[model samples]
Target: MGEKLNISPGELRASAHAADTITKDLGRPLSKALEDIAAAADSLRHWSVGPQLKATGEGWGSALGKLRGRVGEHADGLRMVAAGHDVNEENVLNRFKGW
Candidate 1:
């Protein structure tokens, strides 16, 4: 006998929703922080360390952008999985109805 795999589409969707919320939550604050860093870097451009600071800030911004994109992709994958499971379940039920 094969082991049963119980899948919950609702749970998957909820998790995806949570991930989306997290992405949104991080985006607002981090974006503001980056803007502040950029402004500070501009203000201190004459100082020797100003360019370094700006470069570091840009690096962080790029990394964060990649992270955000990955998280969004994860959320999309979760939704896709949930929908696939839902369709599979529906097809199974329809087969049983014929019996």
Candidate 2:
């Protein structure tokens, strides 16, 4: 006999909640860290001896911001999908906890 995978509405809702939690947790710290890094980078850029170094620092900071910017978007998208699932699943909270 072959085993089949069983999923319940409650499980789906729980998974969506978890996704939302993870997104918030990750986004909160990332924003703070990025701010601190940007401030330090700005200070370093200001004190640099040559224009080249200042420009490099500015370029790197811009790149960092651009790259990390997508994290929040991706997290938000994940959370949006999860929230949709929560609403779409009927009687989600009452579903069985199938293993």
The stretch of ten residues in a row with the least summed lDDT in candidate 1 is 1-10
| Each prediction's number of clashing residue pairs | 0, 0
Evaluate residue 9 in candidate 2 and report its C-alpha lDDT on the 0 to 100 scale: 46
lDDT by residue for model 2 (1-99), tens: 233545454555566566556655766666676566566656666565444555555676566566555555555565666567666664565574463
Instruction: Report how far off residue 90 is in candidate 2 (Å).
Output: 8.8
CA shift of 20, model 2, Å: 0.6
Off by over 4 Å in 2: 1-4, 46-99
Regions of candidate 1 where Cα sits further than 4 Å from its true position = 1-7
Q: Tens digits of per-residue lDDT for model 1 on 1-99?
A: 233555589988998999899888999888999999999999999998889889999999999989998888899999999999989999999989957
TM-score of 1: 0.88
